[model samples]
Target: MMLHPELLRAARTARRPLGLATVLLAAITLTHLAQAVLLAVVLSRIAHGDTAALAPLLLAVLAVVLIRAALGRAQRLTAVTAGATVRIRLRDTLLARLGGLGPTAITGARAGAVRATLVDGVEGVDAYVSRYLPQALITAAVPPLLLVAVALIEPYAALALGLALVLALFGPRWWDRLLARRGKEHWDSYEALAADYLEALQGMATLRAAGAVGRVRERLEKRSAALHRATVAKLRVSLVDTGLTDLAVQGGTAAAVLVACSSAATGRTAATGTYLLLMLASECFRPIRDLSREWHAGYLGVSAADGIAALRTAEPAVADRGTVDARWDTAPEIRFLNVHFTHPGADRPALDGVTFTAPAGRTTAIVGPSGAGKSTLLSLLLRQRDPYRGRVTVAGTATAAYSLASLRRGIAVVSQETYLFHATIAENLRIARPAATDGQLRAAARSA
Candidate 1:
């Protein structure tokens, strides 16, 4: 199965740890082979009624086992560390990009759906990095090495095992694209459910007042059912893929075992050789089985990776805001000079070569009919969005030169729609000026 391209790039961020884990996994596979060889020797010695070589063989087996255990522990630690590092870095990048998109772009988004993608979606990819990546490398490298060892003793057994290995790795290609499509559907369904559930929660009071809570509940249930169906469809493809892999593994082992038994019965291969052949054949398919199992385990994560990749590719609401001056403490004359601004995907300019000036120290009002871009004009003044063409200057200084934070500090707007913070009434009122006295707040409220 193919990993998402963005995920591969994210994985590169933790390359040092993943590389170390790969080496450790390779060592573990080698240790397992050594232990198997020791077992084969011990068994052959027992068949010959020789106990003299038993102690050394057993000691070697113990040593291999201990080494394998140590490698296993180290590999796990590395995997966890690498996975965490990748997740943290990717989440940070995702958040930063979202922030760069500005408030207008993000405000309409479903908070709960975005939260799910940011939290659960990021968490989901841990297995892909921790288990699937290291294991995949071992799966590719170890099987061939084992095949060679088997070939040295019994060529026919080796050939049979090699064919099965090829099929196990290649047979899933035809269905993999379809599985990816299903996986994507599952992820989208989950996001829809989260969005609907969160929207219902936030609008609970409104729903109750309107007596539409039951309707919303039914809609959420439908979304939940859709998610379940998508999950089941994806799982069906995964199970079938896993089953095919198991079939190849079992078939290859049986073929190898049959050849070994026939050679032993005809006296063409010694008991030690037959024993080694059986043990090595088992080793050969171990990686394939692991690859299949981990692929299934990490498949859902691939869907998450796709979501993150898609989000990263989206164009921001505005072009990069270049730079700005320090804080703005006092208002100044605001001028829009032949400004021509067009939003992304708009067919006409919102500003359309507009020229206007609001003199400082005076009350100025902009009146226009609905959809005449009055809000667009305010957005330009605040630098929440920038114009594609024209100059917006405050007190003869280009507004673009002033940092957005500094520019916004000196200007205030009572938006057409009020948005109260989820805090006490006093706290919400105090948001405009944290230092306002109780008397001052009461006076301002009365004035408004």
Candidate 2:
């Protein structure tokens, strides 16, 4: 049930709310212990036929139960709030990072895989943040407290329960590697399937043209089957771990029960003491049980951690963070001086020692066959990428000197391929200049 470091780091962002939630869980655990003791006393009294003393004790038990219920509800609410805060903040950070990376960094990855990281991957951490993390604190704290209570009553019983707790906690470590490997495999399969489906959707027309739609569908079926197999393998490992945990829990409880019965039979402790030992022994394993359940529910967060880390660490194409003004007095001459660039992981440079100049206020057309570096030159001007060697300058000032926002604000681009949002024609046109008036939009439309 070890949490990934990335998940723990993200939890720090909502420490206050999560702290409150953990406190609530600890309070709830104390209530359960109190309830167990109260029930033991009530049962003992009933055995002694002390009907007259039952009223207040039963009322006290009722009050404790009600308090525990209220605390449980508050803990849930606080945990959910913390999860939401972390998810929103993390998503915002990832979005900013992706924006800085630009197309040059992301274009090499599958579109659906990127979308999964931004949406589903972010959501996957919610259970771990909200439930598992807070409960982990309870699991660590409550069992020791319970053991001390039992030890005060029956030292031998406490020792037996302690050994069981050790086994339950550490025995599962034996298979943790297998579980983690399966979890990663499952996430990889999911990403691959998502990417494949998205690619198929985007290229449906091309598939139909080539009469390969059926073949693509068959491939998607295979991908879906692979995902299913991975999921089953992960679940199989989880179920086995759960079985081992349960065996430890039940075996420890049984051992404690045997010790408690022996102490009572030999007249070492009274009925109340025996009852207390029994209840505390069962209660000792409660936190571990909750931890096991939460581990199953929130394991996806562990699997998604790598994806989140990858996006958070990816380097942006324009790392200079330009500061000089991109707004020139006039359309300044743009010069590419002995520029060289190569795409990531490519064997050869896209532009090798290329040099050119476009005069101010002059229309320049760069002609090239497919795969030539014409578009690469445009990309450099737009700061989508920097040149590997030499510099791209406007009026002798390097483009890297201007802030990204200011530089982009001063440039307007019309791409070779046009894309329109799901909006009216005017709305689509207004995307580039949101404040454009109807007359301006009409003029732009007419000119186009």
Candidate 3:
């Protein structure tokens, strides 16, 4: 699937730290490659009884080890910083999108799916940032360096290494289609199980009282079994990928060993060159292995990305037109002109051409039987949902002309099902009128 431009922008911005990490990683790789060549030279000198070469070779190896260790530390620090920044941006963006959706856009979404997306789905990205991203850099950088080193020692060995890399990268693309399908099924089953579990927990008392706990438990068990099957299917894909990578690594190493041995035995290449070829061949596979392991973890992240993208695509309840006049005090009065609305698939209209007017400083009470569209009227006034046909006006301007936030500021709503925050009563009431004095609060409560 094509990634959204906003998501791509966020991903790119979050990956800034990877640039520095890449440099350090490359330095480490080059130093290690140099150390391998030096070790091969030392071995050849030992065979010829040249002990003088051993001292410098030992020192070079020590220096390479130390540098590689330091580089590893720096890479870790950079990876963590990048992961944290990316995670924060992703979470903030998800929350902002959710906030913009309001109640209407989220009406059809499952709470369990949303919870999974916000909690587990977002957290899954850490693996991508910390493991997959850095490994991708190393795979891109280290492989070519190793191949070059191999080419200098044994050109045939270098050719084998290059083929191994192709098998490691593009070979996996062949299985991606299968993995993606299984991954989607796995995520779906997980979501279904989570939804069922939450529903059972919320209505535990009702289920028990009705003697239907057994049925609920049975259904949950079935969902669990389905999830297990999906998980196994996903694992099968991973095992196939692992097998392919291992085959490439082992086959390439054996080919390099044969080429090096043949060249050295025929006196066409020095012992040092043969040793360097073998070592570099092995080094070439490390990055490939790392990449494969990361791809195994990436399956879930790819699936989670689908969920996040879907959430981000949901349209906001109120559009930001950018020209909304916030000066409501001097604007024309709010008016509803024969507004009509019906929810999708509903048999009848909730508001059938309802007309109403509430001028500034005047209180209007809309009393009706339950299901007589009182709440629907309130929704229209709040601009939670636009009319199917007709227009709402605020201060002689269409409701669409006002900014969502600006239009909302001119009205306050109190419903029967009062939603209290997890705080003291004072705090909950303060949400409506933040600057209200304690005396004013008490008077308002008394009036209520």
Candidate 4:
């Protein structure tokens, strides 16, 4: 009931599997109710000194138990599949979004923070998808179902059980506001610690060279301590909520059982009906208890709601579509006309009223000191970003008119710093042209 909307959206992508899992859970619950009735009947008959029904009733109970076990396993498998499907879909979406955003997406934050959002954040939704969400659906259906079954035997007992169910289900909402606040705090601390730790690892050499490793270590310890405190605070709220739920379950079950006992004492129902009502009453709160445990288990997903939402809602830097052809045999002149651009959160534009032309068949060298808009100008040509004002044209056509693939394929850049993948030189070279022949590879290497 307290599910995050973003997490619910992610689950919707795998609704088929989740729906199947829910059906399996419902089947499993029915089996439990069946076993309860059979055992109750068996116990009532045994008390009446009837041994004839023992063997067949016990066998029926065993059979129901076996069927329940099978259904439980199937439900677990379906739920797990749903969770994995959602994770994969979300990761694919995030990766594609990041790709469209290009390198500029990481400019505002450390690479580690992006990675944490992409990886750990998506992983956090698994429990909610696989366990808690499905269990919540079952909880909604099961308690009312048990109430109806008990109503058929004794309406007074059903009334008592239904009231208890309401108390158990709604009692935790009082603490929900507190838990949600603590959960957000915990996630913030966790993300900060993870980001800082990873950034420290990546910059360890620089820290050591500057003799600041000790300072970095101390800072990380402080962050770690903060994270620990946040975690304990969240856990404290969860423990209290859990205690309240347990108290409701116990109190609710006792109230229902007492009503059934009174019904039997008043001769409104026989021993068999009393036993059946008691057995059914015992199970009325089972789904609620399961849901309580699942909420605890899936708390990580709740905490990570913001991170997941951020990734899903990120906008691409530029559209990937274009209509103009970019298959010319010869290089075209590149021109920037009164261009303007700004980095997010910056005081001023990186480029303002910039105009330049690099004629075809001529080499153009753009040289500037650090923090200049030189790199920004080139990024516009690659469509890594669109100009805020004016146009970048190639061969008299605006660069935005050409598809990213064709435009990028027509240009080659030798960056100041080279990055090689963890592969052989040939493999890394082939990344740019996967079908390059051996002679073509040699030519490219020689050209480099």
Q: Pick the candidate with the highest TM-score.
A: 2
Q: Which residue pairs of candidate 3 clash?
A: 332-395
Candidate 4 per-residue lDDT, tens place, 218-252, comes to 99999999999999998999898888888888887
Assess candidate 3 and give its lDDT: 0.78
Pairs clashing within candidate 2: 322-402, 322-403, 323-401, 323-402, 324-401
Model 3 per-residue lDDT tens digits across residues 82-119: 76777788888888999788887788777887888777
Cα lDDT of candidate 4 equals 0.87
Alpha-carbon TM-score of each model against the true structure: 0.85, 0.94, 0.88, 0.93
* TM-score winner, 2 or 3: 2
Model 4 — which ten-residue stretch has the worst lDDT?
105-114
Ranking of predictions according to TM-score: 2, 4, 3, 1
Identify the superior model by lDDT, candidate 1 or candidate 2.
2
Predicted candidate 2 versus true structure: per-residue lDDT over 37-112, tens digit per residue: 9988987788778879889999999999999999999999999999999899889888998888888878877889
**Count of clashes, each model:** 5, 5, 1, 0
* Candidate closer to the true structure by TM-score (higher is better), 1 or 2: 2
Runs in model 3 deviating more than 4 A are: 1-8, 53-56, 203-212, 325-334, 359-363, 394-397, 421-448
The C-alpha local distance difference test score for the whole of candidate 1 amounts to: 0.84
* Candidate rank order under lDDT: 2, 4, 1, 3
Residue 391, candidate 1: Cα error in Å is 4.3
- The lDDT per prediction is 0.84, 0.89, 0.78, 0.87
What is residue 254's positional error in candidate 2, in angstroms? 1.7
